[model samples]
Target: MSVLRPHGSAFSGRLGWGRAPAVVVVDLVRAYTDRDGPFGLPDPEPAVAATQLLVDAARADGHPVVWTVVRYAPGLADAGLFVHKVPALACFGEDAPGHWGELTLKPGAGEPVVVKQYASAFFGTTLASTLHGLGVDTLVVAGVSTSGCVRATATDALNYGFRPQVVRQACADRTPALHDSNLADLDAKYADVVDLPEALAHL
Candidate 1:
C-alpha cells in the first residue's frame, strides 16, 4: 500500500492564466502600510514594491487593474460585526485622521476602485459584474495582509469562477509565519500562489 504524504501533497494542480487577466490590488492602503497605524504590518515595503511592479506591468500590457480600499461610514455605522471583531478597523472610518485609508500604491487614472468593508473584495461589491463586463476571466491578486484580505480576495475570485493567481512577493502579513502559512494553504486549495515574475509575465 502507498503511504500518503501530507495535506497538500495531492492538491498541486495548477490553473495557468486564462484568456483575459486583471491585476487586483487588495487593501494596500496606509492603514496597513503606515508603520504607526493601528493595523500596520512590520515590514510592508517589499510587498508594496512588488505590487507596484505588478500594477505597472498590467498597465503596460493593457490589462485591467482593479484596486480595493477599506472604508466605513462615520462612527463605524457601516462596519457591522467586522469592526466589533477588530476594533482597529476604525482606521478606515471616514473620519479617520490623516487619510489612513489612502492607497499607498496609487492607481492609474480611470482605474476602478472597489470600496469594501469586509475581507473579501467581492463581498457587497460590484467587482464580479465589473470583471465580467471587462471580459476578465483570470485575476492576478496582490496586496496586504496575506492571511486576511489577500487570501479572502483570491479565494473569492476562484469561487466566482475567475482563475486566481496570488503573487507571493506582493503580499504582506503581521508576521512571516502568518504570511507563509496562508500562502501555503491558498496555493494548496484556493489559488495558485505565484512569484512576482510569473504574475508579471502572465499579465
Candidate 2:
C-alpha cells in the first residue's frame, strides 16, 4: 500500500486522443444486464444509460462505433480455458437458458459487431486490424464487468498501440470494490478512466 502512493509513476504518460477516435461498446449484453441471468450485475441500467450517451455522442460526431459481444458454440466448444476459469461464462453459450447473448445496446446500421469467445476483444479476433483499417487510434470503451472484459480490452488496446479511454459511468461490475479498484488500476496504467461528460465532450 505504501508503494501505491505514487500511482502510475511508470505509466503516467497519457496516450491522448488521436486524429481518429471510435466508441467501443463491449459486452453490453443480456447475461450481464438482465437481473435474472447468470452473470447479471445488481444494477446495470446506469451503465447502460451512460453507454447509450457515448454511442449517441459518437454517432453525432460521425465517429465510428464498434461493439463486442461474447458468443460461444453449444457446449462452450470455442470458449477454451476461459470456461474452466469462469464457469459462469456458460451464460454466453448458444444453449444458455435465455437469450443472454443478445446485445443490450443494439448496434446501429453498418456498425460492426465483434463476436468474441474470450475476455479481450482483440484476442483471437480481428479488432486490431479492424481498428487499423478504420483509422481508429483512440478507443472510447464502455461496458459491463469492469474487472474482466473491460480491463482486458483496455490493456490490449494499449499493447496494440491504441489510446484507451474508459468511462466510469459506462462500466459496471459485480461490486463497487471491483469496479473502483479496476478502474483505478486502468487509469494508472492501461487507460484513462474518465467520466461521461468528459468523454462526451471529446466525442
Candidate 3:
C-alpha cells in the first residue's frame, strides 16, 4: 500500500506521535531473513528494504534506532519453553555458526542492539531503560514475522507506556492473511498500523 489508509479498519483514532519517537527493528537476522535458513519465511526483502528508509529517517531525526535479535546461550539454557515450541530457534545459539546468526542490517556505531531470548524486545533486555535514557515516548516498529516478534514488541511498547506504530510495508509474515489479520488486531487496540510514508512523517 502507498498510504497509511487501512481498508475495513475497525479502529477509531490515531495515537499519532509523541514528543520523542524511536524506531525498533526486530529480528531482522539471517535466521528470519535468509530464505534457506531453518526459521526463514518466504522473501522478506521488500520489507527489509522498506525499513532502511525509516531507519535512516529516524537516525537523521536524532531519534534512537534500536535493533533486536534472538540469541541464546549454549545448550539453550536461557530460552525457556519458547525454544521447545520452535526448535528452529537453535539457529541463534551462541555456539551456532557465524552465518546462522548474521544480522541483515549492520547497525551503526552508536545504535543500540538489544539481544533478546524471547519474542518481545522488552523481555529480558534493556530496551526499556535504553529508551528511557534516550527519552523515547513513541516507537516506530519494523521487522520480520509481523505475527511474532514484531507483534510482541509493539504490544509491550504500548504496555510500557510508549505509543507504538507498526509500518505495514516494513513488517512481514509468512502469509498475507497472517500479516493483514495481525495488523488489524494491532490497529484495533494496540498500535497504529501505518505505511512507510506515515511512519516517516511521525519520525
Candidate 4:
C-alpha cells in the first residue's frame, strides 16, 4: 500500500541507504509550524514531531544531524525573490519575534544550524560543504511544504551526489492533496518517498 512508483533515471533507486547517512531538517521553525503565523499554512506539528524522531534516531546511530531555518536581514528591501513571491513570509523579518522559536536544537550547542533564505537549503549555504565534510553519502530529508522546500532540497541533493530519502509522514504541505501529490511526483522522479516508520525500521 505504498504510494511510491518506480522512477527510472540516473537519480532513481540509487540511494546508498547504508552509506554515511545524515538527517537534514529543513525550515522547521516556529513561523512555519505555528498555525497562526503568517508563513504557517497548516498544522505542521505532526511533521515536526516526525522529523524530531528521525533526528533522534540519526543521532543515536551516530549520523550527522543538520537543521536549517530561514533568516532574513534587517529591512524588507533586502528580502529576495522568495519574499516577493510570498509576501506573507515578510512576518519573518529580521528582529521579528516570529523568528525566535524552539528549533530542533538549542542555541550554542550540539549541531550546526544553517540559516537559509530560499526554498532550497543548499542555495548559497554551507549545507553541501558541511555534508561533504561529514562524508555524508545519503540524506534523510524531513521538513515542511512537501511541494516547495523539501522537493527543491531533494532534487539538489541528488545533483550534489547524495542519496535523498524523503520521509513521507515527516513532511507536510498546506493541503493534504498537495502533500500527497508532491510525494507521488517526488517518488516518480526525485527521491524515494518512504514512510517515516518504515524508513526507520529499515535503517
Best by TM-score: 1
Q: For candidate 3, what is the TM-score?
A: 0.92
Clashing pairs in 4: none
Instruction: Sort all candidates by TM-score, best to worst.
Output: 1, 2, 3, 4
lDDT string, candidate 4, 1-203, tens digits: 87987465545454547568888887776666777766575778788778878887887787888888777777766667888789866766676665543463442347878887888889999999999999988889998778998999999998888889999989988899999999888887778888888667644
**Which clashing pairs does model 2 show?**
none
CA lDDT of each candidate?
A: 0.92, 0.92, 0.89, 0.79
Tell me how many residue pairs clash in candidate 2.
0
Q: Candidate 4, 188: how far from true, in Å?
A: 0.8
- The residue pairs in collision within model 3 are none
Which candidate, 1 or 2, would have the higher TM-score against the true structure?
1
* Model 2 / residue 105 / CA error / Å: 1.4
Stretches of model 3 off by over 4 angstroms after superposition = 1-11
Task: Rate residue 53 of model 2 by lDDT.
Answer: 95
**Model 2 lDDT tens row, 1-203:** 34545544576577777878999999999889999888889999999999999999999989999999999999888989989999988888888778888999879999999999989999999999999999999999999789999999999999999999999999999999999999999998789888899899999
Where is model 1 more than 4 Å wrong at Cα? Answer: 1-9
Over 19-121, each residue of candidate 1 has an lDDT whose tens digit, in order, gives 9999999999888898987887899999999999999988998999999999999899999999999988998999878788999988899999999999999
> Cα lDDT of model 4 overall?
0.79
Worst 10 residues of 3 by lDDT: 3-12
lDDT of 3: 0.89
Q: Which has the higher TM-score value, candidate number 2 or candidate number 3?
A: 2
Candidate 2 ranges with C-alpha deviation above 4 Å? 1-8
